[model samples]
Target: MTAVHYWRCFCGILMREVLRFVHQRERFLSALVRPLLWLFIFGAGFRQVLGVSITPPYETYILYEVYITPGLVAMIQLFNGMQSSLSMVYDREMGSMRTLLVSPLPRWYLLLCRLLAGVAVSIVQVYVFLAIAWAWGIEMPPLGYLAVLPALVVSGLMLGALGLLLSSAIKQLENFAGVMNFVIFPLFFTSTALYPLWRLRDASPLLADICALNPFTHAVELIRFALYLDFNTTALAAVAAATAVFLAAAFYGYDPARGFTRGKQTA
Candidate 1:
């Protein structure tokens, strides 16, 4: 297809995703509620028990809520990304995904368009959560809001790519619940989301190493540093590499010759 045709397709797909999000008020509310509960309920409870030392990005001691704000932001994106993949599975079952695949456009490009759309939706949710956090007195540097956009986009893409990879593997809607339990909770809890790496180390060095190796941890760290207007080359590099690998695997998973689609056809 021509460039204009490609652009039109991309726009159409993105708009569809956005509209789907808009129509589903419960989805929006649930996304906001999950992290807010963590910030208000869990963080409040943990503040007294958890003593955070003066870390690099943090100048002095910080509240637990403040420390986990970025992680909550990342969490919003993480769940939204998986939700987008759930929609993909639904679309496949309903035959809409097949229709999308039958288009003349390259499969990878179509998938990328869908990925970008999901990322866009997740970014909006992140900012909304940030706004609520600001209202709740979880403050960051003023310019930090603007500075963190790139990190948000990268992190959103990484998580969304992971969702896409999962969608390609999960053939039926019935199987998704198992995948969510197996994948989402483990990734979130194991990462530096709810607690610091040091805390994990205190518990178990092996657990800390696993958290360090988690791509989601790097995504959270990238956001944390950006929110403080600081640069973390290591986190940035790790997230970038993870995004690349996840996207490649997702692309392969959707490939018709030997991927999920092939399995679907044979079955």
Candidate 2:
């Protein structure tokens, strides 16, 4: 196919996702609600309990709300990623995925388009959360707004690719929802999203090690630093590497000839 054909395919997939998001108003609301609750309610309750010392991202010590804002943002993207892949499972059962995959476009390109579309949607949700938080007095540096964009894109892609990988392995719609809970809760709680690694290390050294190794922790750290107009090189490298690994695994899983899709095809 020519460049025009590729462009058209990408646009078509993106618009469809956008339109789906628009019609499913609850999806948008739900995405915002979870993080907002964590920011306003949970953050407040824990404000006194959680003491965040000066970390790499912050010059001075910060409030619990301020410290967790980036984590909440990452949380939004995480949910959006899983929600996008949930749709993938639905499309597969409904046979829409097969139709799209059968198109002349390369399978990998098609999957990439789907991933980008999900990232675009997640970015919108993230900015809206930031705007609301800003109004709520949780402020970041002005330039941090601009600086965080690249971080968001990379983190979103990494998380969304992970969702894509999960979707490829899931065969039925019903089972995927259970798997989401199984995966999301562990990934969120075990990471440095709510608490820093040092704190976890204090509680249990082994738990701290797992949190350090968790890719989600790096994603949160990446956003946390970026929002303060700072950089975390280790976080950047870890997130980039995780993105590559997840995406490569997703591509392999979607391979109809030999991967998870093969069983579906045969059956």
How high is each candidate's TM-score?
0.97, 0.97
- Clashes (backbone N, CA, C under 3 Å), per candidate, total 0, 0
Clashing pairs in 1: none
List model 1 lDDT by residue over 12-129, tens digit each.
Answer: 9999989999999999999999999999999999999998888878898899999999999999989988999999999998889988899999999999999999999999999999
Candidate 2 segments exceeding 4 Å error: 259-267
Put down candidate 2 lDDT per residue, 45-107, tens digits, no spaces: 999999999877788889999988998999999998899899999998888998889899999
The weakest ten consecutive residues by lDDT in model 2 span 258-267
lDDT of 2: 0.93
- Look at candidate 1 and tell me the lDDT of residue 129: 93
